[model samples]
Target: MAKAKWRSVDGIVLLNKPIGLSSNQALQRVRRLFQAAKAGHTGALDPLATGMLPLCLGEATKFSQYLLDADKRYLTCIQLGKRTTTGDREGDILTEESVPSLSDESLESILDGFRGEIEQIPPMYSALKHEGKPLYEYARQGIVIERKRRRVTISNLTLVSRTADTLTLDIQCSKGTYIRTIGEDIGEALGCGAHLHSLHRISTAGYSPENMMTMEEFEAISEQGYEALDAHLLPMDTAVEYFTKVDLPETDTMNMMFGRTIPSPVSLDNGTVVRMFDQGTQRFLGLGQIKGTMLRPFRLVNTSEFSL
Candidate 1:
């Protein structure tokens, strides 16, 4: 049989990644479903974790970085009393300690210490690079590498529920905040040990869980034909909806498209990033930054499909 044909499709697909599949595995499956010529995922989720995995197709990949830098939300369950090598249920038990009979007040007090800005040492069994190799590779060989502590913000951390041996939390954190580390730290604070039993991302970059589509849903839609699948693709501009918008005249839009800086028609702060669009045509031009009272193009979208 011949290889599958690829087409230039542009848009974002908010995928509800299921557990047990790495982010890349999920992306490839969705790419094949859409038959997209080019595709990429904004962020990665471990095989044991699941949640919203935004897939960018064609030109949408150009703006994927914006989403990567945005905040994330997750619901995590921690199994207290046992510490693990990987800080998760997948790791080997490193230590076992008796869990203390804890009260809401005491647990809340310990969690408050972790809120706001704090330092976290990256886990050894992680994708972080060490001398051009992943840290997990060294971890698999029983080689431990020293890692520097990086600052991350925990914007919101609230106790969702709890049982005798387990605690559930709803977390809203900045980019690079590891839920596994949070679980381990909380366990330590509680005078017991803990590891992430399960984690589910609820939102990221302003996209909520309700916007996500599961693989089964996408597969069912695929059977209806390509149009049905394409209908689920969000416009590329959705990636930068958080930025201020700056509409330009046709002439300035053309100039910016050609890499020339044009005088800003709107009053915006210097160094402000803005989403650019053609005022008359209402077509998205790209992204620009205000510098010295001029709008400089940072990234311009391919406009072959647009009449502008």
Candidate 2:
């Protein structure tokens, strides 16, 4: 059997992650299809969740943190009257109760309490670490660790739909906001008890959910040719689109390539992050920060990596 050829690839692919696969599982599948030498996911979705899982390839990996730290939106279905150990469908049913009458006004009132900023204790079955091991590892061993409350902002949270046993919600919140915890907390507030019935990330980091392609779609594209696959990949600059952009002259860009801080062409506030491009060719040169009225290279792209 011949070995598959994997080369450097630089771009972002918006993957509509399917259920039954962990975030890493989905990333690996996409990476293999691209024959990418390096890749990473912006954020991890639970095996039971399905949603936008952005895959960063090669040079794009350097900017993945911006996506991770960016705000996210999700559509979640919360099942009332039952609570699970893992807070989602994957866990054992821990408690059950009769669901209360869910009227629009009452539900809105309950949800209003969760809007804006609120404190939440991270779930036991989470990837967060304690002493260098994932919290889920200890959770699997039936060890309960006291977790500190984290403050998260829910910019938008509205009831999308509701049934006798379930409530659907559209939520836009800051990064690190756990949808499962929201469902469980809402259920608790209603005296019905609750667990996450389903979750789908609608968007993240200003990337359109409409651009997300499913695994099946990716497989079909792979059959067409590398060109077809490359067409779907967004440029690495899109990863840091939130940052201000500045173009440096050829000589200054050359200095930047060597990690030198060049004078900002225009005055910029200290700590302002900017994406740099070559003034003449306009090719992306990576990112920089304005510190002490100078543009200091934060992360520079190595265009030579793709020469192979």
Candidate 3:
């Protein structure tokens, strides 16, 4: 059969990623479904994780960096009393200990220490590069490579509930945090080793899973054609909606799009980034940042193609 022709569709889709597919694998599936000429994902979730995977198609891909840098939240279950090679249920068990019966106050105190800023040693089973090779490759070869401890902030960490051998947590953290590492550290503090039993991203980039389109749902709507699928996508500007919005006159909009810096209509702190838009129509132009007193375009959309 002949391959379908790809089209230039633009927008964001909030997908409730099912467990077992890597982020890139999930992205490819969505891209083919939309038949978009270009597509990207904000960040990768472990194959074991499920939920809130944001897929950006066409011009929406341009704003994915903001989503990548945005704070994220997850609901996870940390299995106590076991240390695994990969730090999750996927890897082989290296050690096991009897989980201690503890009071809520004691468990809460141990979790508190993990809150705020903490340092973590990236796992060998991760995609982090070591001498241009992914760490996981070395892990597969049984070669223990020296790793460095990197700093990350845990904005919020709440103990949701606990089972006989599992502790469930609701974690909101900054970019670059590895929940697997957090699980190990928390276990060590509690005098029992631990590994992540399950992970689920609850939200990121100010978006939640409540509006997500699941794969099961998409399969049901698949044969209805692309226009039906398009109805589910969010406008490209929604990715950068957290930034301040600045409406510009037509002349200013043209100048900004053409890579010219224009005088600011309203004063904002130097280096403050804003979303640019056409004044009268409120059409999104792109993104601009304040330099000294001028608004310099940083990332401008192709107004000729989509935005007027």
Per-candidate TM-score against the hidden true structure: 0.96, 0.96, 0.95
Expressed as tens digits, the lDDT of each residue in 244-300 for candidate 2 is 889888889788888899999868789988999988888898999988878898899
For model 1, residues 1-308, the per-residue Cα lDDT tens digits are: 22259988899999999999999999999999989999999989999998999999999999999999999999999999999989999999999999999788988988999899999998888888999998999999999999999999999999999999999999999998888999998899887889999999998888867889999999889887778999999989999998898888889978977889999887888998899999888888889998978889888888766666
Please report how far candidate 1 places residue 84 from its true position, in Å: 1.4
RMSD of every candidate to native, in Å, equals 1.7, 2.0, 1.8
Write down the RMSD of candidate 3 (Cα, Å). Answer: 1.8
- Candidate 2 local Cα displacement, residue 15, angstroms: 0.2
Clashing residue pairs in candidate 1 (N, C-alpha, C atoms within 3 angstroms): none
Q: Residue 93 error for model 1, in Å?
A: 1.6
Give the distance in Å from residue 73's predicted Cα in candidate 2 to where it truly belongs.
0.4
lDDT of 2 at 222: 90
Off-target runs (Cα >4 Å) in candidate 3 are: 1-4, 306-308
lDDT of 3 at 66: 87
Candidate 3 TM-score to native: 0.95
Local distance difference test values of all predictions, in order? 0.91, 0.91, 0.90
Which residues of candidate 2, in runs, are more than 4 Å off?
1-4, 305-308
Name the runs in model 1 displaced over 4 angstroms: 1-4
